[model samples]
Target: MTTILHIDSSARPGRSGEQAHGSHTRRLTARFIERYRQFDSRTEVIYRDVGAVPPSPVTGGWVHAAFTPPAAREPWMVEALAQSDALVDEVLAADIIVAGVPMYNFGPPAQFKAWLDNIVRVGRTFGFDRSRAGEPYWPLLADAGKQLVILSSRGDYGYGPGQRLEGINHVEGSVRSVFRYLGVTHAYDAAVEYDEFGDERLLRSLADAESATDRIAQVIASVRTRRHAA
Candidate 1:
């Protein structure tokens, strides 16, 4: 069975047309998962709603706890890292991670950022050794086969690679960088733009994004099925 870690980070509780000022990213991720499941029946989805209940922001205590060796950590440190440990376990247990993150300002919502902070822990998701000849930091999960699919939304246009506003667009770039560091080497993204202007352009963009999501799901399902059979 394929295990998918489904994460929704949009503050909006519902999908567009389903709720007032609903999240476009939520709609895209829902469609992506639904379509993906049609291709494979034996699938397990672990849902996490960071929007409604976000992970606690990393504090000095969290830092100390994450950096300390597991066996050496004190009781307080262990308590501090409990949530992060759980989050990392969920990521490690999944073969695929599908996240719905919306652009706030130029980057992801603070809620999603907190979730990233929780999971990207040293000695957990990454490794550090002072007695190394080369670089000491390495991704621990690099050998683990995992894929990341990000569905995002934006209010403005021109955020694609080489686009006019690409330099300022940190939404997908930030998430991809974080996941890449966590050893999610394979990644896919599909987004909807022109959200502020809910006009014909928005409608067209949403439609296009929906099609893109469907195609991505099909492609991923094919590759996963082949791998499973192999």
Candidate 2:
């Protein structure tokens, strides 16, 4: 069975139209998973609500613990790396990751950023070897065939390729770049824009984004079916 890791990082806990001041990203991701379940009833999902309880930020102790050799680590080192190890395990087990990360100040919120920090652990998601002169660092997840789906929202608009504000938009770009570094096979995204305006444009963007999420679910399901048949 396929496993999906669903993470919602929006500060808002409710979905748009479901509650006052709700989150669009959350709505999109929920829809994606809900629809995908129709195609594969046996699919398993691991949900993580980072928006409600953000992961702890990476501290100096975490860095030292992560960099140290696992066999030589002290008790304190193991304790320091505990949360990161669990987070990395979740990513390693999933075939797909569906993240709801609303743009905050042109990038991801502090909670989501902290989650990223916790998962991108040395000797886990990535490997480092000082002795390997030409390639000291490498993505340990390479050839893992993982996929990341980023459901996002923007306060304004124009954050796609060659769009008016593409150069400045860091939300999806940063998230995608991080997963790529970890060797995800594909990174997909859908976003609702004009949130600050709250005009007809916002409504239109929301509808389009919701539809995109459904389509993404279908695409992934199709791939699974083909693989099963093969």
Candidate 3:
């Protein structure tokens, strides 16, 4: 069975507009998974909701425990270290990852940032080899053979060849670049622009999400087929 890691990172549960936007992404991803499952009953989907509540930032103790050898760790260090290890394992076990990341202000929410910090560890997702000079840091998550699909919602960010709000689209680039650094070569983004929060705009956004769901399903099927063929 192929495993997929599904993640959602919008802060609002049912209160804010951003939450509403993320809900659309969540539904779309679910639909995509359902479509994928129809063809492959053996596929397993694992979920993580960082938006349920704010996630804690990695602390000094977490850093120490994460970097230290497990055999020499104290009891208090065990829990934090274990959490990080489990998160890493989840990422490693997945053949595909679908994540919903809403734009907050100009970037992702703090919970998403916290989630990223937990999974992106030195010597795990990346490494620094002293033997190398200019290229001291190297990627270590290369063997996972995973693909990432990102769904994002933004406000007032128009898309075009020469859009004035080009800077606001940095979130997409950031997600792609960081995941690439972790050796995720196949990363794709699907975004719905909810710049206007009117009822008409909302409906349009939902329709776009429906289309995106179908698109994702096709992508998933194609990738799984290629994997099996290989």
Candidate 4:
């Protein structure tokens, strides 16, 4: 059975009027997961919440431990390596990955970025080799065989012509590039836009979110069916 990893990176709790972007993304993710699980309960699902309170960025100790051979690692290094290894292992095990991310200051939040940095490692998720020169790059994540779907929340970014927040494209582009760099070539992203607008616009955004969730469910089901057929 294929493994799916679901991640929520929203810091807010339910029913808050302040309404963070990640909140809507999280709701959409939950609905998608419920539908996915109903279709295949036997498939493994791994759920993680980085927005609830994510881990800190990797430190010097972590860097040293990650480079060191496991047998030679000191106790302190072992502890640091354990935290990063567990997260990286989850990514390695997953066949499909789903992430709920909200744009903060034109990019992903610190919490979510921290998780990304932890999982992406040199000689782990990817590597560089001088042998091929122009294309000397190699991927350590190739064996994981994973695809990705990202649910993004943005305020006032239409992803179309002449939007003031057009720069928001960085969010999607960055995610796509990073995932592809890690050997996930088949990745897709869906977005829920305009949360900062007042009541009417917020309601519209929610409606868009609901529609996106439905579409995501359909896509997931179709992909699973195709995989099963193969």
Candidate 5:
């Protein structure tokens, strides 16, 4: 069975129109999940709400403990890395990952940053190889054969290619960079823009995003079906 890791980083709940508190990205992700389930009932989903219960930031203690060999680490060191280990395990076990992230202040929220810090361990997601001449850093999670789908919500428009705010849009860029470092090259993005200007523009953007997300779900389902048959 295909295992999907669904992560929501919006500080809201429920689908759109259910409550005014719900974020656009959360509603998009919900629609994606609903359509995905309809395509494949046997798929397994593991959900994590980082915005509601953010992971602890990586501190000095965490850095030291993560670098230390597991066999030589003290009890406290082991405890410090427990969450990181678990998060890494979840990623390693998943075939697909769906993430909901909202653009806040031109970037992702601190809650999403904390979750990224926990999962990107030195010896876990990536590694350093001094054996090379100059470029020694290599990704351990590379070739893990996984796909990532990102759902982003932005208050303003013109964040796409050749747009007015393209250069300043950090939400999609940051997410792609981190996942690329972890060896995930096949990543897709679906975004809802003009949220602050809630009207016909917002409705049109949401519709476009929803269509993109549905297409992605269909593609993933087809891929999983082929993999299962093989």
Candidate 6:
């Protein structure tokens, strides 16, 4: 059975109509999950809400433990790396990953960054080979052939290719870069923009984003079906 890792990094919580309004990305991710379940009932989902309960940031000791060889590591090192190990295991087991990311100050939120720090570890997701003259940093996790779907919610518009705010839009680009480094090449994004401008533009953007989510869900379902058959 295909295993999907669903992660939501939106800080907002509660219902959309509530005083503590939920984020657009959270709603979009829910829509995607609903459609995905309709496509395949047998699929298994592993959900992680980083925004609600963010992982601890990597510390100096954590770094030392990660760099140390497993065989030579002490019990303390092993304990220090337990969380990161679990996070990497989840990714390695997943065939697909769906992440809900809300842009915060032109970049990903602290919760998402903390998760990234936990997952990207030496001798785990990636490997370094100094003997290989060039291109020493090789990704070990690339062989999994996983697909990544990102649901992004932005307050402003023009963040796409050749757009006015493209240069400043670091959230999407940084996400792509980090995943690409870990061997995830098939990445897709659906974004809801013009959120700060609460008007017809916001409504239109939400509609378009919902449609994009539907399309992505369909594509993922089709590919999964084909892979399973093969």
lDDT of 3 by residue, 75-181 (tens): 98888767677778888889888877877776777887888888888778888677997998877777777888887776654642277777666677777788888
* Superior by TM-score: candidate 2 or candidate 4: 2
Could you tell me which 10 consecutive residues in candidate 5 have the lowest summed lDDT?
12-21
**C-alpha lDDT (0 to 100) for residue 165 of candidate 2:** 93
Could you give me the TM-score of model 3 versus the true structure? Answer: 0.86
Candidate 5, residues 1-230: lDDT per residue as tens digits?
Answer: 77889889988776676787578888888888899989998778888889889989999999999988778999999999998898888888898989999998999989999999998987788886679788788788788779999999998999998999999999988999999998998888999998888989999999999999999999988987887789
**Cα lDDT for residue 152, model 2?**
95
Q: What's the alpha carbon RMSD for model 2?
A: 1.0
Badly placed stretches (over 4 Å) of model 6 are 15-20
Which residue segments of model 3 deviate by more than 4 Å? Answer: 14-22, 159-162
What value does the lDDT take at residue 153 in candidate 3? 70
TM-score of candidate 5 on Cα atoms, chains taken together: 0.95
Clashes of each: 0, 0, 1, 0, 0, 0
Q: Put down candidate 2 lDDT per residue, 61-152, tens digits, no spaces.
A: 88998888999999999999888888999999999899999999889999999999999988889888889989888897888878899999
Model 1 Cα shift for residue 206 (angstroms): 0.4
Better of 1 and 4 by lDDT: 1
Model 1 scores worst on lDDT over the 10 consecutive residues at 123-132
Which regions in candidate 2 have their CA more than 4 angstroms from the true location?
none
Whole-model Cα lDDT of every candidate shown, in order: 0.92, 0.91, 0.75, 0.76, 0.89, 0.88
**Top lDDT model:** 1
